[model samples]
Target: MEYIHGRTGDQILGSTSIPAERKGVYQYMATAIQKLLRIPIPPELPPPPPPSALNNDVFRLVMFLDTEAPRIYQNADQLELHLNTIFITAHDICFTELLYLHMGSIYEQLKGLSNEPMVFCYGDIHPGNFIINDDGHITIIDFSETSILPSSFARYAIVSTSKLSRG
Candidate 1:
């Protein structure tokens, strides 16, 4: 395992204490997602461990890790707040009609994702999972939930549930 030294995106946003920096956080996150999308999928991956190796002891260990892991937000309120902030920032940086159009396509794709082309995605992209490296670059962490799904799923998942309207 390699060591990464720096703050999480959440920490950077919290410490900056500036509303405008929140927009930068969204841009940083976008860059990270773009980078993640560019990574070539490994042609072959190791299979899961045998059931014998996943005995009670190992199960307990895995459960502990899952429950204790740091997450982006603990509940809906936090998620809503963050999404609201991101949307506001995004709106300021780009044309509202374009953003709406992009979001509309995402929603439409999500509605029919099962029939769409798929791609490997991080599966989970929250502020806490993104590391702001010491050199000021965004790096995505945590691949436990990675999977291949509709290419539009990521975009839809990012902003679909938000209160932002199609119009």
Candidate 2:
């Protein structure tokens, strides 16, 4: 399948013209996500949530939005600057608020994690490779795209609906 530049000037394989193969991949991905979403989060995966950690998910989301905006924008150059500004400013605000909430302990816990970060992610979940069936439920088509990292997982949960920047 040949890929070309999209209206956004991004090189995306807009139409693969290979529905059968793509459909198979999609079916597999949808089933996986469905299973993962239903499974209870494993106990040893992430650190237990502190009372203040309720907002951590939101914090992760904003970061994900910042990371993804550049990819989805039609005018990447123009949107990049704006997204960077928003990310920085939002992060500043986020830290400012979080610092006051007995975050010292939290930071300590996360500090060691910097060297070996752990994130949970539903890696691919992009719109182009996904479809909504007659039942109006969305299905993911590619499992090759999903991944988990501590930072990224935080971002996804926050920006769960954000589109991946098409490439």
- Leading candidate by TM-score: 1
In TM-score terms, candidate 1 sits at 0.50
Reference-based lDDT, each prediction: 0.48, 0.37
Tens digit of lDDT per residue, candidate 2, span 26-107? 5644564556555443334456531111222222133333533223332223333443455355544333322222225323
RMSD of each: 12.9, 14.3
Expressed as tens digits, the lDDT of each residue in 118-154 for candidate 1 is: 4455545667788877677777887665544334434
What is the model-wide C-alpha lDDT for candidate 1?
0.48
Per-model TM-score versus the true fold = 0.50, 0.29
RMSD of 2: 14.3
Worst 10 residues of 1 by lDDT: 52-61
